[model samples]
Target chain A: MEIIKSPDALKAALKATQGSVGFVPTMGALHIGHKTLIQAAREANDIVVVSIFVNPTQFLAGEDLESYPRRKEADEKICSLAGVDYLFYPDVSDMYGEDEVSLIAPDVRGYILEGTSRPGHFSGVLTVVNKLLNIVRPDRAYFGRKDAQQLMLIQTMVKNLFMDVEIVPCHTVRDSDGLALSSRNAYLSADERGEALKISRALTKASHLVGKGVLESDRLYAEMLAVLEPLEVEHVAIVNRAFTPLDTVEVGNTIILVEAVVGTTRLLDNVWI
Target chain B: MEIIKSPDALKAALKATQGSVGFVPTMGALHIGHKTLIQAAREANDIVVVSIFVNPTQFLAGEDLESYPRRKEADEKICSLAGVDYLFYPDVSDMYGEDEVSLIAPDVRGYILEGTSRPGHFSGVLTVVNKLLNIVRPDRAYFGRKDAQQLMLIQTMVKNLFMDVEIVPCHTVRDSDGLALSSRNAYLSADERGEALKISRALTKASHLVGKGVLESDRLYAEMLAVLEPLEVEHVAIVNRAFTPLDTVEVGNTIILVEAVVGTTRLLDNVWI
Candidate 1:
């Protein structure tokens, strides 16, 4: 697990390795979700590269750019134990410059659900993902389905741009209580952590309702909203695989998503039916 | 040369070729200028790919996208003669979809010069260029300096995005009468063709003045404007290699650009000192 800091050095190092490469890009403070992505990358390719870049461009002005978790030593240990061939940890200066080119997310798909709450968030995700993909030039890139919209958009970007890398989406990893693991989970206080479980509970309730033959989107939304209760829920959307609004759940094609604020920390979770 | 109509086929074909690829992307109507670009690619790399895509996004609503010059058979023959290994010719449908991810050029640099007349032009250029580069995966891509600003922006895009390809800027090809070679020259009548000579002539005057050590940008612009009299000149800009406006030319780091409307057709030419 050789840790590389510069983009040029990573490119140079990649050129020396003659095999299929699998990459998992993360923002440090590695959780089980990130580990799942890394393990998937490790199993699939001869070379596994993990990039820990908490890209600043992805964070909006009021967002947690400064307070974002950064456990450098722990992240290095995780990558080393996961058998990562290269750990690319670049500074903000190393990745970006003044007056840089950026990407714009699609009008319809990018501005819905999560995009609605965070307007320019997907664009920032896309720009940094593009830069990382270009830098790694991986044969396959692994992404956890925890960030469903981001994973979908990245898949769209790769297809639209004709980028020559396969996008492998790993299933979302969660805790025993069903709460989706996130780096932002670090921000939750003891009582706030208990409140966050309602997010996963809401998603689970929606899945149970679907299993009991309740397929209508409105019914599912209503039931999930009841589960969310007095929490400041951002949205409870029941959409198909393409993120298109569905009148009724399409069984295997449906995904029930929920976002809620637990104290000051916003938590997200979803269940694929 | 193998003519690949689909991007998938081109990528598959390129994978079989075992060396560095040099690419030249054009809009067909392969004149001496395109031929010069292909020749430069042939001299540099193990494989040469030339794509003839008259990208519709780059053209504004009222612009001549429909009337854009295209000569398929002639362009094919030109590539064959120039020793091009592959010629990717994808349709608009093959290249784009209804909802797509796109690149946004740097605000300050992308919205000036040609961008002022045709807003959102560089975004389209950057998007298509990014797609083409990803599709072709060229080691070195060639561009003519006739579109000086475009060349600069593309270079900036490549650098800012951390793209791996080397951008090689070729000298602008010219006619015996000193008119810059362009596919759009096909739109000009005999009288308009003669009037187009004024664009190159103005650039020549600027270059000659700079040669004589008259470094003041204002004096050079005035002289070029005097030579371009009675023409619908868009702009006479004296700037550094980075396209930053200059009060005085920096000798080796200077570029004098001229854009003029020869009758109904817009013509562009520049001299790099």
Candidate 2:
């Protein structure tokens, strides 16, 4: 596997790929969720490119901007083992500059859900994703369904901008304790880690309710909130595939999302029907 | 020449083109200025694709969006004569949606000069321009130096986004009277048209003073302001190549810009040293 850092090198590597290219963009501390995305890309495309960029703009001033996790050596090994054709590792300086042009998310869709929770987060994600997409120009770009809102906003951005690349949404990977895989999970202590499982458990319980013919969004949210126990839940939203609030679930198109705060770290998970 | 209206069609046309493709994006009331850009594109690349989109988002609430000049038949004739390979003519509805992803210019650079005059204007310009460039994926994109600030911001956007396309800055086209050529120039009455020449004249005077060893930016702006007599001038300023305000003229690296209100229409012209 070729490891590239610069945009020019990435472009040259992309140009050399003869057929369809599948791209998976990440923040370096690769987990099973990222592995799932890469695995899908490997299956679908002749060439798979994985990018590890710890984009600075995506983190807010008070957020974990300074303390975001990094596992470059492990990430490289994971990509090598996952059969990635190219591993693009770019630093902050390689990506951003002073007095730069920026991407702004939509006023309505962008300001709700995860956007409202982490203000300016989606803007940073969309901006860096825009840059990566332009650089990779992949036939299909893989994103984990774990970040439901981020994936939604990115898909919206691609469609709204008329980007030719197809967005392949992969299912979330989980730990043995049912915690959705995330690099941030490393920040949690044993108790915090155990508490994080409630997030996924809540979503699972909501999915169970829906599976047993429960269509009311309120009931699903209520029961899921119960499973969340005494955790400081951020939001328990029941929305359709479009992220719009749903009064009644429509079997194959419903999504029950849960976000909870375990000390300083926040955990998010969802189940798609 | 092939005429494509849909985004998919344009991309396919782009893929079919051999060698470097030079792109000229305009709102198609083709005048001599647009002709100059087209001619330059023809000279630089094996294929040239001209896009005519009067992007509504770029216009403010009370701006002349609906009344914006468009000469479809004449535009087609000009493209044919200029040897354009493809003419991308997409409508406003086709270009925009209810919830749109947009580009926001940098706070400092965006909210000054023309951006200060018309709020949220550059964001719209950047968004539409970004979409156009992505669709074409051309080797080079051309822009009129008449909209000097727009050209600068676009260059910033392309570089900041790490896009592969080269930005070829084309000289502003002018009539014998020294009036900058613009589709909006048609909105001006014959008397207003004559008054518009003051913009170019002011820039000409500034250029001459700078050529003859004028080093002070303040004196250059003051003298240029005096030459544009009795006209309602918007701003007269001197800035470096990066559009950052210059205290002293840097000769070969300076740009002197002028904007004046000719009746109800705002006209801009600048000279790049």
Candidate 3:
């Protein structure tokens, strides 16, 4: 596959293509999760463009931006294996500059749960995503539901901004033990890796409870919290598809999310019923 | 010309057209100023789309948003006369919703001059302009040089966001008396209209000094200030095309701007050398 580094090169490459384009944006250290997104793009569109940018803006101060894993050589091999047409790898200078206009996330929906723990995170995601989307101009863009809130906010941004692209949400990929695949999972030790499973377990438990007709949000949250008791639970939130908190869970319109610190690594997982 | 009120209808209408589109966004009350923009659009592209939105976000509290002049019939007639293919007229609800993401103007450049006198004004302008640009997806969008700062910022937004549209900066329209044309000119009484000529006259004086090799910015600013005497001058700024203040005038790369209040009406005028 073709590896493009500059925005201009990618633009030139995209312009030369003559069919529907699909895009998958990611931060590099590819896993099975990323592969699934690429696979979907490969099957649907004549041209597939994947961007691997470790966006510094999305990471809060004192976060792991400095030490985020980078497997450039491996990533290039994976893209070729995945049948990618163009792999866009832009540097920081290629993406941002001094004195730039920025996108601000919605105040109310942008600052709860994940946003509460890491303020201005979604804004950064949105700003970079907007830049990428404009640059790529893909007919369809794939995003994993692993970041459910992020997925929701991005869809909202596309609609609100009147961008003419389809945002396809793919299901979250997990390990055999039900641990959600994340690049940050590299930070976890063998023990913490096992502990990370508790997050998904909590989500699975909440899903099972909902399947059995336990509709009260408070009870579902309490039961999930019990499963995540040993870990440092950041939040156990039950909300509608719009991310608004609900007193009672409504099946097919509810999502249960959990975030917990297992050792030094922060892990998150959610289930939609 | 076909008039479209809803965003979906406008999208459908735009999609049905199959050629380069030229867009002119305005707040109705069509005059020679708007006619110039539409005429330029008509001459340049196969399809011309005009949007008349009195954006509330761009108006500050008690800033006459509710009382802004809107001549719908005249505007429609003007568009048809100018050979516009479609006219988009969306209500506030069609453009905005609860808990929406927004665009923030650059901190340093966006908060100077007109932005200084009216805080957060450019932010609103940038936000709405971004929305309109994305919605219409025009091949070329036109703006007047009368609002010099606004034109510059919109150009900056398009460049920074990597939006795929050309921004054509048109010459500022003027009356026989050399007064810049503006819809707000409708608010001025005969005396106020006579007093408003000072703004353009100041710009003309600055132009004359630059023509005579007066290179110092302070000298140019002082001469312009004298021309705006007895008027409540807001600011007299000498800057490069980038809007950064310059110590010495640079021919072909300079802009002289003036803003003054005549009675209750605020008037602005500028010249690019």
Restricting to chain A, the TM-score for each candidate equals 0.98, 0.97, 0.99
Per-candidate count of clashing residue pairs (backbone under 3 Å): 0, 0, 0
- Write down the lDDT of every candidate, Cα atoms only: 0.90, 0.88, 0.91
Clashing pairs in 3: none
For candidate 2, write residues A47-107 as lDDT tens digits. 9999999888888888897788988899999999999999999878888888889998888
Task: After superposing candidate 2 on the true structure, give the runs of residues whose Cα lies further than 4 Å from its correct spot.
Answer: none
Native-referenced DockQ of model 3: 0.87
Model 3's CAPRI class is high
Query: What is the alpha-carbon lDDT of model 2 when measured against the actual structure?
Result: 0.88
TM-score of each: 0.98, 0.97, 0.98
lDDT of 3 by residue, B28-86 (tens): 99899989999999999999999999999888987889999989998899899889999
Top TM-score model = 3
Predicted chain A of model 1: TM-score relative to the true chain A?
0.98
Poorest 10 consecutive residues by lDDT, candidate 1 chain B: B255-264
Looking at chain B only, the TM-scores across the models are: 0.98, 0.97, 0.98
